[model samples]
Target: MEQYVGLDVSLKETEICVVDGSGAVLARSRVPTEPERLAVVLGELAPAASVVVLETGGQSSWLHQELTLRAVPAVIVDARRAKAALSCLMNKTDANDAEGLAQLARTGWYREVAAKRPETRIIRSLLLARQQLAKGRRDIENQIRALLRGFGLAVGAVAKQRFETRVRGLLEEIPLLQDAIEPLLAVRRTLLEQSDGLEERIRDVAATSPVCTRLMSVPGVGPITALAFVTAIDDPARFKRSGSVGAYLGLTPRTHQSGETAWSGR
Candidate 1:
């Protein structure tokens, strides 16, 4: 008989439940959240049926990748959908949630979301880091500009390459304000340097990736946009229709209707 498995995962521990065909509970256990421990539990309890269901969560992507590597079939369910289904239980508990997930697997009632590739995740993280550094640098520059404004020093239309020079020239005689702003400028320099490093890495990624190279050939599409599009798409062939991408990305018009309320084209 095919066994279905459910795992209610938490930060430190996971509640697991196994059910055989016809929805009979077979075994239940709680184990450390580490993939190795979970894999061992599933191997012993389900053996031939290591396929388990869990809800999407902060750690779901990482856990899915690790479990798949260990030869365990891990299925991620939409958290909202899983919540809606599990909330109907009379008593709410982690163990009950696990059982509910097993039942979901047994009946094939849950929708599966595509797992993100590790490469995509890594590149996306780098992009986010680069964006954060850029924002930080911009904020520092704005703060410096604000300080200069207090002294009636209008840093008017200064190019990026000349921003530091202009600010220093403006404060040449005003050592007090210059001293106050020097630290911020130093921080900005550090942020700018790191941002540039990340940008170079992203450019290298774009240059190495065939898809990113093609994406960059289009006007207005640069390394960041190309990388984001490639990572978001994951697998282009997964979409049956080319136009479906717009809908998938939520760029296309969508309609929502409730009792006496209708909306379209968000």
Candidate 2:
């Protein structure tokens, strides 16, 4: 009797359910969320299980990759789709969700999501860090400007390089204001240094990547933009047609149609 497996994964534990080809519950158990432990439990309970389904989440990508490495046929399903199907049940519990997922696996009625490679995730993280640092620097600068304005001191329209000098000049005679704003100026300086370092590293990575280099060749496409585009796409092969790229990036409008009426909107 062939079997199918479903895993309702949480941070620390996973609820597992096994079912036969006819969708009859064969066994159910709780195991640690670690890939090795889950693999061991599955081997003991459903050694012949042909498909194991899990939902997409923070840990799903790592678990799916690790399980595949252990020779388990792991499938990552879209959580939204799985939730829609599972909502039909009266009782919402991990065990019941596991059973529903097992049945979904048996009937092949779920959408499988592709897990991104670790390298791509790393690049994405760098981009996010750089963005946060830039935002933080801007926020600090804006706060300094606002605070200085409260005392009728306007450090207006100054270049970034001269911002600290301008602030000091405006607050030179006000000892209390100087004391209040010096710490913030120091923080802004550190943010500037860190942001510059991150940008340098990002440019280096983009320069070395053949894909990013090609993307940067387009007019107005800089290193940062090229790297972001490359990381966002991850795999070019996923798109069958180049024209569909605009839709994938959400640049195209959404369309709505009925029996006779049709409309498009952002």
Instruction: For model 2, give the 10-residue run with minimal summed lDDT.
Output: 171-180
Off by over 4 Å in 2: 89-93, 149-160
User: How would you encode candidate 2's per-residue C-alpha lDDT over 14-100 as one tens digit per residue?
Assistant: 999999999999999998899999999999999999999999998898999999999899999989899998999899999999999
lDDT of 1 by residue, 2-40 (tens): 999999999999999999989999999999999999999
What value of lDDT does candidate 1 attain over all alpha carbons? 0.90
TM-score between candidate 2 and the true structure: 0.83
Number of backbone-clashing residue pairs for each candidate, in the order shown: 0, 0
Positional deviation of 161 in candidate 1, in angstroms? 4.1
Report the Cα lDDT for candidate 2: 0.91
